[model samples]
Target: ADAQITSAKIISLDAGKITTGSLDAARISAGSLTADKLAANTITADSGVIADAAITSAKIASLDASKITAGILDAARIDVGSITVDKLHALAKNLVNNYSRTSDLTGWTATDGSIVTDATLSAPVHRVTTTTNRQILSDYFEVDPSKTYKVTLSIKCDSADGTRYFGLHAIDKDGTSISVIPFTVSSRTFGGASSNFYFWSKGGATGGWLNLEAYILGRYIDNQSDVPEGKVVTSHCRMPANCHRIRLRYLNYGTAGTARTSDHFSPTVTAVDSGAIRAENVIAGLLQSVTGNSWISLDNGQFSFGNGALAWNGSSLSAQGTFEAVSGTYLAKLDAGAVKLSNSGVELGYFSIQTAGPTGPWITAAAGASKINLAKLVGTGLYTAYQIDWGTTGGTSATHRFWGTVTLNENALYSGAIDCGAIAADGVVSCWRVEPHLDNNDRCGTTTKRWQAVHALEGYFNKLTIGSNTCWAAGSMSLTTASWASVSFGKTFPSAPRVFGQYTHDFTGDIGMLKIRNITTTGFQATIGGSGFSGIAANWFAILV
Candidate 1:
């Protein structure tokens, strides 16, 4: 019994430490053992025990076909470089058919020209055998009129000495060329120097067909002014390049045209280099507008306005005004004439016609051919100043009266005749009076007064030595002098003169006192007594009152 007990104990101990070969499927109890009882990474697909709830994600080393389920992966889960170009091309749409011309010009039509496939060129070439314009047009392509596109092409000369004119034309649904932009290429070598030309096109067709045309013609003469009407030419002296690799790219579109509503035009060409010809057209339009009433300033020296109306050339400024029928009153006007104010000195800022006083009302020119009387008054107003008035009353009229005060500074000079009243007024109404004020020695600050009724007088004193208070006259008389041998005074005095007379050669026998009776303001008359006197001489002095 002891031997049996010991053996059973050893057997039970060995059973608890059983090796992998000691355990069999039958030894394991179903639903009794779990994955928690095994070490980490001990259960895997190779272990049949993992048939249900097979290894959790944490136990896997990496993912593979056996680890992942079918149709469970998506683009987001797929790694990069897994997709091919063939796959992408199958999903996208190509707007430009036959973009590379893999097949010979299958999607293009040539008018008056033929497509020439050249080994040297990357794409098919357009060959023109005539001087007339030729075109290679693409099939009508559907496009959104509200979008803009960039059209590009590479151009070079195909034949040496064979210059060509090349341009891009946009045709609308109505078959009318709406926009045309062209350039020239001038090169003598095959595959000569070429330029990449780019242009913008705002889609024009509205629910209609739109197409692009490439035009090729003989090289345009440089600076040629006699281009045929309705014909396209290049302002530059370059031959067109062998154009190929034409492409259209999506750009900002949807811009409207300047023409009719619902009518769209191609996008405005904005390339500064290619659009120079268009600039000439724009300048021409501006010049036309200048012919009307528009004013254009060019630089600082040149300016123009209206149609031959006003212009300032490099030298002078010119202007013209039209003469229209006069209907109402005008203060001042220039009719069919021009008033130029060009001065190198101090200029008048403005002129005013006002009343005599500084605070007086404004004065307007008379209506029609009416005249306003003018008068000059000196030292008349409160300020005792000189004034020029429009009316006879010196700016005192109830209507149409104006005056301006004249303040003469020191050393001021006026050299002109003052037409007082008509000739009937004796041409002398007042004389300018300059008086120094006793208050100050300054002549400019002195009070000035004009003396009225002052007349001018002139005379000659002949051989007379008169005193300071008297004027003397003397002359000779012949022996056969008449009864009235007059002694003449050359000029007049302001008032009548008091005459004192004596004869140097007096008559002795029939002596007579020298009578000086007819005394006038100008001169007094003197006579000798006898007519038989010869070689007689007389002298007299006349004192003027």
Candidate 2:
């Protein structure tokens, strides 16, 4: 049993003095007695120290394929929700070639890993070196008939032969070239260097490079007025509606013996749509006058004539008159006939009978013919009576009572009065006054008529001058006959004028305005008489001159 325990005949054996601290892991046999073995935790707790430091095959744990899976050993497994943003970046760069979304795009490029740039289609890159050689680019235009576009080409010549000429053309879809613009490359300077065309090119180490760009711009068709600034025009519509493609090209135009050489060149052509409509700019200079015989229509559905009309809507009863083009100074060709002025063949006021005068408005009448003519009173007087005669060539005095109608036409030209007081043939000699009233009484009225406030007739004269509130005269008077006994201011007197003092009346109803006549006076003195009336005291005054 001791030999078996010591394993002399066994395949391996381990012998040692069993000290509590000794560890001889190599000396132990591979298949030791199973019942004598102790648990690892129990050995470690009881001994408080490890026996052997060397690792050997006898102490290894068993490996099982069933315990292992992809989650435990897969190198690249990731939690779909918990994967970090850095992982996504690496995935994007390594998995997708067009990771920045730039693939097969003609006008775009991956400027950075994340940004795509709009590489605007420019003029073809020049690759030739020979002189007088021309290169044409392939067709890359996408014509859209739904829109209209403008083709603009901007070029500059840095240092060129002075005699060299250059030109540009816009090739339409129909194989037609339109000369949109033409400019000269005169000798100029750019970037502190001498050049043939300052605006054509910029000189650098590679040689002189020119920047030529083209874009689809817009313009107003109706604005046939002026050119606009900036690379694009916004205020005008393009012509030939719904036309789109715009092509640009450069040509050489120069005198013989001069080469048109361009070192480096770039041309940009943009495809743009029409933007918002803009108003055309007004020209800076003064506007020229435009005259045409065309008629303008008003929005209110009315057309105005070359001339205008003067119409009274009868809004008020106040008197007013209209004036047509004048024929003479104090005369007008009236519309009505001379008979239109008569009420009847019988007189109404003082005079009787009527006949047309030389310059008629109010006609004259012979006494026996009936109808009073008011124009016969030629002197400045209150009630000077003159006889109408059918018996002689001149009128003779006649006394008769009458009644008549008086028409006051505002359009009539009379300096002082429209006197209609001579109607003696009619039974009642009544004279009606219907002057214009601009106040509360807009209509004419007999009761609102104003009576003259001064009485002085010392004239058979052509001119008269009255004072502010006094009546003075300077005309010849026949002191013998009472036939010339008439007052200057009033149409009638309460009594006769005893002497010149002052005169007044209650002529305040519709009697706001006054009209007085100036006639020739033969150096005769006139007077105002109003001392007797009480109401006349407030507005009464006297002046000699």
Candidate 3:
């Protein structure tokens, strides 16, 4: 009906209800409808009143998200699983690479029997199934120092003991642990039936170990903590300060009693959580501890390792504690002024410098600071068989001074008169230096033995050659008549020997004389001085000056 009539005025409207298109949308004001104009609960939603696909996205421009003010949209109105990840715009993303089981986990480094295994775990996991201490360290990731970050690790351990756990640490550019950085355990959810929410943290002495330890505590059993097998633990950490980089450590330590397996799953490290990172291991703690004047300092502007134990710093370097090499087998310990070296915890020997001697410097070594039975050899005989025979007289065996008959090859100095048993000679007997001061006055030996040694006939009766001549020699030879006679000697000298001989006959008044003329190394020549004499003998002698 295009027109309606009012009963009172007989107009063209009957309360505007009988008219079609009487109140057009273009002519109607927005929000002009009043509930009083209609009966309460009059209009109902049905196929007759509303058509299908009537309420489209374009039609909902009146009730869009911009129009959602002063109240929250009921989540119940949205179907389950209708809101997807793509629907949420600019959500905080995980900073960790391969957080899901999307890759082989190349972002982690395995240490000590840790590996990437795809076994019974639902996804390929970073795992360790060793009897030794096993760990896997994640690769260093860049982080923001301003915004707070949260790291989540999904780990499964065969041991519920707290010893098997994971840790979070911040490192520098050189991969060294940074001190004075603090973090918090934001949240954690345990999976196993026997999982405990308790954790333990140890502020290490050097600020390098056990910074933040999130572990799986065992269920109580008889006042002792017992482990549950195949437990899964999830930990979320929020760090306040990360100057350079961050790494995660998942470890299985002290699992000796039983074999243990640890598995890691989908993890995340996002900067969604907000908080201020506080200080923990500050350098002031370390600087305050560097007390006393005996600090580690540079000496002589140079540093060098002296021997295998001590390090030379200018003049000296005193080591405070035991210094172990890269391999634990080699160790150097300092006790007093000596440095003891060892291999595999066995004290081998030590090197010490004798500082109290009159000499300048000496390197002294001792054997384990104890008297141990050891073997030594002298020549072809052992030291035991070559014991010195101390020839004692006034004292007992223990108190006797060494006057033994033993022969030693060492340089010795004696302070008493020597009573020789025998001075055996197997080679040439030659005397070099002989200083005879027999008298109380240190002048010389008495004239008797002094002259006797110089002109001894029987003691030293050998030919002495002085450059080109011999000392002295004498003998008797026979000479006859007017013939030239030769004086024969027992042996020849190294040089031409001097000969002086006078012929003396046994016959009375035999006037023949022998005169020596030429001398040679072999022999000497002599001729008769008297004429025509026979049957006579002469005595001859030879000497060299």
TM-score of each: 0.21, 0.22, 0.24
Give Cα-based local distance difference scores for all models.
0.38, 0.32, 0.46
For 1-545, candidate 2 gives per-residue lDDT tens digits of 55456446468544554546765788678887475577655655247466565556587688687857665645456455775555543223221122123222123222211222323333333322223433322233444544434343333333344222222223456655432221121211112211121113222222333333222323232222222232321222232223333322233333134444432233333335444433353333322224322222323222222222322223422212332234333223222232222223432222213343544344455343543423444476534243343343343544333223444484432354222322124344222334333433432444453444233322222233342222322222211111222324332223323222221334443322221222223121332222121212212112233
Clashes of each: 20, 50, 8
Tell me how far the alpha carbon of residue 25 in candidate 3 is from the true structure, in angstroms, after superposition.
77
Indicate whether candidate 1 or candidate 2 has the larger TM-score: 2
Better of 1 and 2 by lDDT: 1
lDDT of 3 at 181: 23
User: What's the CA error at residue 93 for candidate 3, in Å?
Assistant: 7.3
Q: 1 or 3, which is superior by TM-score?
A: 3
Q: Mind giving the per-residue lDDT tens digits that candidate 1 earns over 417-502? A: 32222112223323232322222222233344333432221122234333222233333333224555455555555667766554
Question: Please, what are the lDDT tens digits per residue for candidate 3 over residues 1-545?
Answer: 55563557565655656555465679778888888877776776652666777667775645556756687758888899998865642212355554344444556663334346445554555556667666666777777665444445555554544356555566656776664221122322223221122222211121211223232221111111112221222343223343467666666666675676656665565653222222452232211113332222222343323322444466766555465443567777766666676666656556566445664433332333222223367888744322222223222222112222434566333333323332333454332323232332322223432311321122111222223224444555555555666665666767776565544423333253346766776677676555565545544544443
Q: Which ten contiguous residues of candidate 1 have the minimum total lDDT?
A: 263-272
